[model samples]
Target: MKKTIFLFAILLFISCKKEETKNESLYPEAEKSAEEKQLELGQAIFEGKGNCFSCHKPDQKIIGPSIQEIAVMYKEKNGDMVAFLKGKAEPIVDPSQYEVMKTNFAITKNLPEEELKALEAYFYSFAK
Candidate 1:
């Protein structure tokens, strides 16, 4: 009887651990889905209301540095690009053209926090 109970308890503990592991795996998938959704929203805003494409391109410089360039610069600084968007942080990528960006910040600074975060995610996605 003692042997049987010990075996049963060990089996129960193993099963509970397996379930916990399964739950841990699920969390990242859900988080990835949310991040993807945010990226989609950011892309829409960049191409639409943000008017970002007017001055910036994905891989090459236009009136401003490329999106990839901005991503690399921000990642290097470990910077808060969202705060930069909100006009709370200074430009780290291209201070020489900050005057041009200042006009654009007038629009970006007004964006809601969710949109700003989404935009930052979208920009970071360009980094290599």
Candidate 2:
């Protein structure tokens, strides 16, 4: 009887642990902070609908400045990237690329405010 009770207790402990793990997996977003969620949204926009990845790479300059470069510049200068995307602010990262980026304004200008902020957060994510 003693051995049977010990085994039952062990089994109960294992089941509880499994249940906790399952819950953590099921609601993964619940564990993410607001900033993390914003970054994810920004990444989706940059890679998908925003089409930013075509010109800007994460670490190296392609058709435009790298994300890290932009983030560092903006952080240092206190520039407003979201305002630029909205066409309310001048280009601060690469004025030479302004003409090229203008072509994308039609898409960026139409994004929801939340998405624009998310994109800004994503860019700033690379700031060191």
lDDT leader? 2
TM-score of 1: 0.74
Worst 10 residues of 1 by lDDT: 26-35
Give all TM-scores, in the order shown: 0.74, 0.80
Write one digit per residue (lDDT tens) for candidate 2, span 11-122.
9999999989877786788878898899999999999999999999999999999999999999999999889999999999889879998998999999999999999999
Best prediction by TM-score: 2
Please give the CA lDDT of all the candidate structures.
0.91, 0.94
Query: What lDDT does candidate 2 reach at residue 46?
Result: 99
Report clash pairs, candidate 2.
none
Model 1 clash count equals 0
- Which portions of model 2 show Cα errors greater than 4 Å? 1-25
lDDT at position 77, candidate 2 = 96
